[model samples]
Target: MFSGLSAFPLTPLNEKGIDEAVFVRLIERLNAAGVDSVCALGSTGSYAYLTRHERLRVAQLAVQHAGDVPVIAGIGALRTRDVLELAQDAQKAGAGGVLLAPVSYQKLSDDEVFGLFDAVTRSLSVPLCVYDNPATTHFEFSDELHGRIAQLPNVASIKIPGVPADPEAARARVDLLRALIPRHVTIGVSGDAFAATGLNAGCEAWYSVIAGLFPQIALAITRNAQAGNAREATGLSGRLAPLWALFLQYGSLRVIATAAELRGLVATPCLPLPVKSLQGEVRQRLAAILDELELA
Candidate 1:
């Protein structure tokens, strides 16, 4: 379903509300840059932070502007019913597929996790991508559990978050997923820093954050790697080392937004009250990183 660079754009906002124009521009940029797919309301989009109406608007705009690129909508929520509702809205909004992460205040058990997906799959017509993002969800998927979910009807893909700072380990993890999961299902890689390694190791796609802001660079990496120019691809990704280190230190949620803000793609950084943007020292360090990368 999702392959290559599935760009997850940052949800831009102004004091009034979500900046619709900025949202469209971001999606259009990815589409123009030839990203394989667009994932609106993904972790980078702050799906859990936005109301249903806000999330739907982002999905609608993403689908409308994506052109030939498939738009995958993130339908994650704290409860099963809410997730189901959002998934329906996403499909209705013309999203190509829906991504769901098992988010909970209370830790979810393997059976509970399976049941959540089972119920949602029963109600959905479009394919679902199991989002295994432990950083935000706090619930890790054992390979056994992911394999069980893969067997469920309508579950078409699984997103594997990479192990930052360990390229070899990340590739090994990707190898494990390909070995354990069904051959028919797609396995997409997140963690933009290590994703080049994941791609070289045989993952089908890069579900990227930087791709949202810098689709051209992201696409270059994937295209080169897929074309067997892995050394070239790795070298290109190596330029993003400083930024990746920042993401690991503070978090991509912060660093990506800060980068987007500096790039003039958005009027403000990743937003709304309560969500911290960037600070003094950190902002200074980010500036140096951006300058080194020569990103405007």
Candidate 2:
């Protein structure tokens, strides 16, 4: 049950398999930045693009470089058995916990969803953190269902995306949903764009993509917000506003991949086939912002 800023490093891919040297260098840089925690093979990590062997290799590298800090292995798949096997692999690879999401082509009923979680909980040895990314999955869990799942043992936390930009509405939602979670269970915000508002609305920690390239700024904002420096946090958020806007306005996946490229964190920001790259104004805007921030 790790908290605070847990950065999901984007696993750079090339024509070959898992770019080992680049991946290792990225992990070492993130660890040296004093990150609270790191995750591999998540959505940002391009897990869907990797094979089973590649996922396992990346997970091993992440855990190896994580040192004492907790390593969260993102084990998400369309099949129950496959997800379970990956979870088992993560535990064997020295991961501290597993981040599971309901990944299925057919939209399942609440009963089916509950059943899937029940089986996963019973099968895994380590704690499980459920990821609620409705944008990608198109199935958002109701608070009632979350309340039921939170009661189970070995369930560590829930990752909720902070949709609906209005801070007031977002705050109300967080407060209500947080009540459904047991006192011991932690709540994290995954929407990097609205993370500041989410944190102000009672989120204990967050999962950020921006932290991959600019961990120092992300860490500064986290510390400021946690220490009750609202103005400072808001100011830092403004500094990051350009990048956030690009992710929201344009292609989020491209912007994220490009950030790694601009920072020289990865050899090439090559996304999976069918996922296009940014060009012209979009690429120029991202590059200019990164330059302004001196991320290069």
Candidate 3:
């Protein structure tokens, strides 16, 4: 379940609440694309903004509509108690695995982060993926800390941030983590732009944002890299350099939400409040890029 492309679809919202019908369509699209797994409530899914009830329903909808694709639900929360509750809810919602970022309002020490995973894993029957997304979590996981957490029961994968761009450095970074964690715990790389590099460097999975809306292109990169066609995979990723640049400038969530809107996969301003849709010239540029890349 943790060894290939995991698509993180956006949880579209309307004024009433979660746009369940649209969200289900997104999941079904991923299923038809044959993605290895569907990750609901991920950072791209705006998990942090949704209420517990909304998140539970999103997980249920994902699992229910994903058919045979394994559903990995995000169970992150600011409080451990709430995280525990959400983890249980996700399990009950039939998630095959859960992704957990160390969400916090205050800076967390390594021990506190470790304790969070320990507590959650103890109660979780489903496998847990350590979501090392420092960009949003505001807490970085030291290699040693990751090693410690990987030892816990049900720790199945570590979703590391992007690797070094240089090939040798990327491999060394992945190799160092591989040596630290148990062999069974796969290393999945986030940061969509780094997918090809990380996969070519030995990461077993790609937890992708772009894959949510454009699964076929993302799958081509994954398949090529896994088949030892490094040049082909890197070439494929390079073809979308303009899109990656946009991601760098505006953040992936906003950019992808904008793309979803342009593609008519979801309504305009599909993102939650405080996160307005991309506007003005940037949105136009995005559309042009998507057209040029044949993604639209």
Candidate 4:
């Protein structure tokens, strides 16, 4: 599993399918910025939005251009069999590991969640990281469930979101996971807003959204926390607060895509139709914010 700044890239897309040229450019930019690892088809990548074949091709594209950097493919799907097939295909495509989250068609029991991961991990030669994103999955894991999952063979990490809305609580939660989970299993803090606090509280990795647009900012925060520079990390996180506010209000996918568009990184604000990217007043606010940060 990825142990440092693992950027969740927004898969640059065209109206019909994946935009190969723009996607390649994004990966090349990430590699040039020296992100520790990149996760293709993550929540930001809109994994569920793509066809199975599109997902496979996206992984192939990412792995081909990853160079020396490790690529972790998101293998989440609504069905167990689909996730399993995706994991196998990811390994075949030379992905370093697979990021699996229990996607629900209906509310899942704890046993059902365990079973889904168990089936996928057992079938994989590569490592598996459990994505513990309750907001999207709507299945919050209990502490006991987390321990049980961590002990699973070839299970390598857990991603926990830490938004600034709940800093002390987020830190306390990270602290508990640090104590409860095995040393071998890394805990990654997602939610770019609260990453600094989570990192200071001892999260081993950051699964970041901001890094998809501004890797240097993301890398600096992680490095600062790793070096015990809490003040510096906190400051960077503060600078990112405006963007995070937009994320909390409008979702990270939309805001990050707007940031990419503002920078001329992608051709158009590409999201699945009906799920619009930022527009009008929000777009103007985002442009102003990015300009203030000198990121536009």
Candidate 5:
């Protein structure tokens, strides 16, 4: 059903490369804090920067430390064949499922979208979660379209990131979409800040970057919200609000990397090439926010 909080941590890389000790430590912390699952090599993990080999290794590490928990490996790629290849590798590495967006070359037609799934679904032995981040893909999979995708046997979930400017609209969109999918197909909200609203809108679960940093608090919010305890959810979310705000303010993947660093879970806070590192006032603000949360 994909309920509760799931941590999606950054894939740390040192000069010597893939720091197993640090990676294992991060996964151990997430497990102890009650994270329902862990996602590896996603946007927060700088998947774009990693080679195929590194991605496989990260999946292996995640599976090794996940114990009984499910590990969803992000298998998104520009090429359809490559995406399926990674999905196959993910299953081989013992990942519970794969998360992927539509082909990134251009906005895909409905037919092309279906074809993308047609190719990738064949290789996915486990459940598949569709990623619908329009900001990244420049393609928004409408609720109607997602309903169609939900019919696929391997299609077990959907990931949507709402526009932060208009949360009400986001809730409405999520609600409309949630109503379309069958009960068995889990609807997963990806944006941390929108998770509570998504849950209230009947989303089955969520994928949270903040869960990677403060998994216990994320678990609290999800548990209370799921139980229909709005007051408890709000209070716990308030404690985690500062960290979410850092992601909004700092403006990039640094928030995830920095959060990992604050927890002493990752080897380096360095984001991959082309993405700027947090610095000066922005860095100080993040530090202050982490302090306010007592997570620094």
Candidate 6:
């Protein structure tokens, strides 16, 4: 469940609430693309914005539509109690795994973060993926902390941030983490721009934002890397440099939501409240880039 390409689909929203039909189609798209797993409520899915009931419903919908593909439901919340409840909800919804980040309004100490995972992992029947998205969670994980959390029961994977750009350094970073964690716990990489580098450097999985919308290309790169065709994998990622640039500049959530809207995959302004869709010249440029890359 932790290996290969894990696509993080957006939870498309409408005036009433979650656009259930659109969300189902997105899951079906991922399933059709043969992605290794579907992550229903990751950062790209706007998991943080959704209420507990909404998240549980999304998890259930994803599992229902995903068919054979394993569904990893995001179970992050500000309080550990809420996170635990979400985890139970995910398990009840038949999620294959749960992705958890130490979400905090107040900065969390290492012990507090460790406690969060320790508490959740104990009650979890399904495997748990440690979601270390420092960009969104605002809590960076030290390698030692990752090692500690990984030691707990049911910890299947650690979704680490992107590695260093340099080839040797990237490998070194991954290697260092590998040594810390147990052999059974897979190391997955986030950051769409660094997928190729991280995969080639020995990351077992790519927890991708772009894959949610453009699974074919993401799968090509992941398969190439997994097959040990480094050049092909790198080339495939290089072609998407324009898209990656936009992701870096505008944040992946906004860029991908905009792309989904442009492609007619979802309604205009599909994002949840307080998170507006892209507008004006940048939106136009995104369209141009999509066309130039033959991604539209």
Clashes of each: 0, 0, 0, 0, 0, 0
Say which prediction, candidate 2 or candidate 4, comes out ahead on lDDT: 4
Cα TM-score per model: 0.95, 0.95, 0.99, 0.96, 0.91, 0.99
What's model 1's overall lDDT?
0.87
Candidate 5: pairs in clash: none
lDDT for model 2 comes to 0.80
Off by over 4 Å in 1: 163-171
Off by over 4 Å in 3: none
- Residues 91-188 of candidate 3: C-alpha lDDT, one tens digit per residue: 99999999999998999999999999999999999999999998899998999999999999999999998999887899999999999999999999
Predicted candidate 5 versus true structure: per-residue lDDT over 1-296, tens digit per residue: 25567678777775446776777877888877878889887777767677788899999998999888889999988888788778888999999888888747765788788788877887667988888887667777877788888887788888878433344675677668868887777878877777776665666677888787678767878888889886677577666676667766764377777666655666554566566557677667777777777763
> What would you estimate as the lDDT of candidate 6?
0.95
Give, for candidate 6, the lowest lDDT window spanning 10 residues.
Answer: 287-296
* Ten residues in sequence with the least summed lDDT for candidate 5: 162-171
Query: After TM-score superposition, what is the CA distance of residue 203 in candidate 5 from its true location, in Å?
Result: 1.5
| lDDT: worst 10-residue window of model 3 | 268-277
- Candidate 6 C-alpha lDDT tens digits along 167-239: 7899999999999999999999999999999999999999999999989999999999999999999999999
Q: Which window of 10 residues has the lowest lDDT sum in candidate 4?
A: 161-170
Which scores higher on lDDT, 1 or 3? 3
lDDT of 2 by residue, 38-81 (tens): 87877888876777778888899998886766788888888888
User: How do the residues 1-296 of candidate 4 rate in per-residue lDDT, one tens digit apiece?
Assistant: 46889988888886777888898888888898999999999999988888888888889888888788899999999899899889888888889989998888799999999898778878988888889888788888887888888888888999876634455776778777767778889888898887888888778889998887789889999999999998899898898788889998999999998888878988785777777789999999999999998884
- Of the two candidates 1 and 4, the one with more favorable TM-score, higher being better, is 4
